[model samples]
Target: MTTFYSHLKRSALIILMLNSFCAFLQKAHEITYVVGCFENGTTETLLEFDSDEVFYVDFEKGEVEYTGPYMPGFDPSQLFQDLQIYKNALRNSKACKAIVAYGTIMEKQPSEEKDPPESILYTAEEVDKGVENSLICFVNHFYPPLIKVTWTKNGQPVSEGVSLSRYYPNQDQTFHQFSTLTFTPTETDIYSCTVEHMALDRPQTRIWEPDFHHQHFELDVFCSVGLILGLLGIVAGTFLIVKTL
Candidate 1:
């Protein structure tokens, strides 16, 4: 899990490909090696290996420091040497230049050409009165991760007991995210989830009522009883026909 988290974090940080033109002309190429520290499940880039200056994030003090970048199981010298080799290669290779050009082209691509997101609002289980419930609004198949989810109860905005999850990547280069609203439902309370994105001209709203769940439960029970009576009638008719034969 730690390895996976580190890979994901590095993937997010390594968005900009370091392809410096005129590497010899500049004192340092645009290459930054980051060494992130993880404790429990939280991780942050604590060490930044730069050619000019090195720094780390001091989350506890709420400030970043440049005094000394050090970690227990890391050697900055080897990292610097490896980066230097790559920077030297970047100076020589025509393929590297082509890659840099391609990356530039991709960066300038228009957002309008990308597909919009699809969102669905639902709950983990049936919402019942006086029971703790989790109302989830799922937004998926989105190209960009810009989205807003709001929950409302009785036509009023609800902010408490709400949490938004991180953006999870999909296989097709899209993203998925979820927002949860935890509350104890009541008989007359009406809940709604609204989603706002660039794809929609107006906010998309989905409403939920506790009474509907109760109605569905009652309908299911009624259907089950009707099915049982029909089966009994069929059995009795078959027995009577056998006796007559």
Candidate 2:
């Protein structure tokens, strides 16, 4: 499925400043209003404070949802006095539908360009043998916004503790997504994440494995050096005491 969006934004700012010889303080806050219409006949209206979502209109349920904490001294009722925001969103959706229909009839649809995705696989924390950790698969910069992600351990499919996130839009109009797997690190286990999308001729895979042997070797060398130094220090102390006596 493909979706096109018509976006509109409104902003209000509040600034306060206090200046004196001893101290100076300034505080500035902004409220953003956004309305959008999707090609699938869905509409979204949002109110954000400092880029954090505070309120959104749920057209399907015919209600306004409070998505974030209440802001002191800000009254949401004022914005919905006559439900004008909802009405505007409905009108915008209708206009978008009409435009899409006209474009279809005229054979003037948007360009069908495909952008391939880039993916990376990494562990959430330092990998240690027998330690529970999470593997993250990040995929970005893909167009059309549909992709499949799967995980495998030691060449076998892994289903438990796998999760996929919703698509997030990028500034270039492409999209990004994330998938995660929960697994325990082992010296002999290998993990892989595979991503498949329409833009790719074949699926892409990333692999990860633990470096337990390397880490253990480094630790052993460190401990051996420390033991040698400790023994030399004891011998030198004994020699000093006997000569003084």
Candidate 3:
């Protein structure tokens, strides 16, 4: 599967090819080739196998980076040379621009295949006041692979200690992403995660707050029940000893 993206035009071109040998062997494998061309004459190329990145072209460094081990009988040097040839051909060709133009036109003609993302915001660990913890915002089942996720603390936008994961493909061909925020848990503080995507009419936000009172109440009830059960056991043992004697 090859996917090309033109960020300047906000469109994608996908090409799928299957290897007969792999199919005959009953092994399901996938190859992903990505070419990202920008308006500033900068290009990005990546090759992945089985969803794991194998190598990428570092245009800035003018080198090919081998991120992972290659498949059997595959030579990294040969692959690098082949990529150079492909890159040179693409640089002098207008086919990418033409495909992006066609994709843009197709994008305008919307169909009925939009899936809105479902999101949840929660703490990574049990809430403890003044203790550092992580908040996770998971968004899944979204289409088109474009989304914006933001975090806020007490109604103010939070920037520090935030990280986002790369888009992961789901079985249904939709995508899922995760955003994380790190902060100290405070009883009076509140947090929210907001998600924006084209499939939704408006942005969705999920809020989270620490409820120490409720937690304490449940703990108290559990302890009280345990104490009562222990007392009952002790009383029953004493009565049995006395009757036996």
Candidate 4:
């Protein structure tokens, strides 16, 4: 009777331990994630996947960042849907850091979404049809970094007789992108700026001055600018001369 009673007690304890272990496994399989946007910017964390490759990044890193798994296959997209909760997750999650090592687990990459570089349209001080060599101005409203400014004439890239200035940020938090192209701009010439970025919808601008002002306002503007420059030069030269004396 004592031996039989011992056997019964051991059987009950084994069953209880098995049930508890199953409950713990179920809880571990639950999925959880977090998304945060600090002062630097916004980002998402995809937790506990089979792979550990960091796929996406902010694209302002001075290199064109085009990465990620865009196509959604049945197995990959479905399995990944369980954990990824980014609104633009699949689209902006293309970081190129995936590789197979020791194991063949699939992975996802991170992508950056920067404000698209604005289109540049040439705006002149004049507003008429025919005039001689008017001052050509390129005006574009940008959002900030991750952009390169270049000028093209007649659809060909050119760098001669051109000038570029640092971006000016407005009080309202908009970026002002400026580049100047100097040439004998003719009606047939198409002066434009090409902006390069990671997005397929990058920047290719064609400023149509089809019938803009051509009045010779250079003298007035030139005189004003010249006077200021002259005065500055005189002041600087005077300071040097006085110091030498």
What Cα-based lDDT does every candidate model obtain? 0.59, 0.70, 0.72, 0.41
* Candidate 4 Cα deviation (angstroms), residue 92: 32
CA-only RMSD, every prediction: 14.6, 9.0, 6.2, 22.6
> Which pairs clash in model 1?
none
Model 4 spans > 4 angstroms off: 1-113, 127-144, 172-174, 209-245
Cα displacement (Å) at residue 153, model 3: 1.4
- Name the best candidate (by TM-score): 3
TM-score of 2: 0.60
Q: Least lDDT summed over 10 consecutive residues: which range in candidate 3?
A: 13-22
Better of 1 and 2 by lDDT: 2
- Give the per-residue lDDT digits (tens) of candidate 1, residues 80-197: 4444433333332333344434444555642342346677777787766688989888888864456788999999999999999755445354567899999887888888989887
Can you rank all candidates by TM-score, best first? Answer: 3, 2, 1, 4
The lDDT, on a scale of 0 to 1, for candidate 3 is 0.72
lDDT of 2: 0.70
Model 1 Cα displacement at 115 (Å)? Answer: 2.9
Per-residue CA lDDT of model 4 for 135-237, tens digit only, reads: 3444444433335767777778888876765443332323455666655645566666666644426556555544333334655688899999999999999
* Candidate 1 residue spans exceeding 4 A from truth: 1-112, 212-245
Which order, best to worst by lDDT? 3, 2, 1, 4
Quote the positional error of residue 158 for candidate 2 in Å.
2.0
Estimated TM-score per prediction? 0.50, 0.60, 0.66, 0.34
